[model samples]
Target: MKKIYLFLLALCWAGVSFGGDFVVIVSKDCPLASVSTTDLKRLYTGKLENIDGTSVSGTNLSMDNPAAVSFLSEIVGMATTDYKSFWLAQQIRGGSTAPAVKKSVSDMISYVKDNANAVGYVPKDAALDGVKAVEVK
Candidate 1:
């Protein structure tokens, strides 16, 4: 029983240590102001056509980061492997291209803030103001 309890405790610790955080950001004046989980998923998945009544577009930072992966898995409800496969299939099908992927968090934040209809995700601790944080369910 002690050994089982030790193993469970270690597992919980590892989970907590490995988890990452991210924030979905939009311009302060984005048309459709707030976002629910459904809205966010729609926007990220290219299912939504617009933001604040205008055409919608979003960008994502490099997928190699933990925070980026966490956002996809936790907020978007997509496992890492499955998400990669989905993007790959989209590319093969020539579906509406994926979001313009940024190389760094700063670049993503800059692009989203400068483009009225653009949205993107960054680390939760990224220091930027005037960008609205969309709460994910």
Candidate 2:
């Protein structure tokens, strides 16, 4: 039992430490070709209203998702707990809510593909048939 627990813990740690790269995606119809991490952080945090003349909305995967954790910590500069606390305070203060949460990568892909103003992130291996991947600098 102890060995099993240790193995599982190592597996989870490996996944977090060496997760696949992720891409920020937007609808193909969106005019912007790419976005910097600064701009992405702004968009996701509701600081930016538009990108390159197109109105933009952001979506996030479930808080517990590994990709979500990576994006929040590496790109958004916040831990999962900190991100949640920030949003919670924003809500209590009657500010804008957090980005809509997608249940899975497929849901995120579908939402970004269908909504011209939407932006989202997914594991780089995920299918990206209709949406455009934005280069992160």
Candidate 3:
């Protein structure tokens, strides 16, 4: 039992280490090609109205998904509850609400490609056909 538990722990740790890599992406027509963490935070919080001068708007994959949570904690540095609460406060303060979350990375990618101004992040291995990957600092 102890050996099995240890093996499971090792497996989980390996998965986390291997799984955290991610990529930020935007539509080809999106004005911005890359973004800083500051800009991303602003955009996610609705403080920045535009990316590369065009209006920015769109949703990301939801917190309930592991990849989404990993992206938030590893890339954006916010825990799920904190991230949602942050957006809620932003909405209450008249800042734009957090973008509506999609059900899957595939759905998010499709949504972003169609929306022009939409942007999102996904696991690094995910296919990026229509969207351009952005460098996130």
The prediction achieving the highest TM-score against the true structure is 2
The C-alpha local distance difference test score for the whole of candidate 2 amounts to: 0.83
Q: Rank the candidates by TM-score, best first.
A: 2, 3, 1
Clashes of each: 2, 0, 0
Off by over 4 Å in 3: 1-20, 92-95
For each candidate in the order shown, give its overall lDDT on alpha carbons.
0.74, 0.83, 0.77
Q: What ranking of all candidate models by lDDT puts the best one first? A: 2, 3, 1
Winning model by lDDT: 2
Q: Choose 2 or 3, whichever is better by TM-score.
A: 2
Runs of candidate 1 with Cα error greater than 4 angstroms are 1-20
> Model 3, 46-90: lDDT tens per residue?
677676677877466877877778777764579989988988887
- Between candidates 1 and 3, name the one with more favorable lDDT: 3
| All models, RMSD in angstroms | 6.7, 8.8, 7.9
How well is each residue in 33-105 modelled by candidate 1, as lDDT tens digits?
5566666677777678675567778677788977778878865789767777877888898886777889998
lDDT (10s digit) by residue, model 2, range 17-124? 334367788889888787777878888777887877788888999988888988888888899999999899989999886899999999998889899898898987
User: Cα deviation in Å at residue 114, candidate 1?
Assistant: 0.9
Q: Assess candidate 3 and give its TM-score to the true structure.
A: 0.75
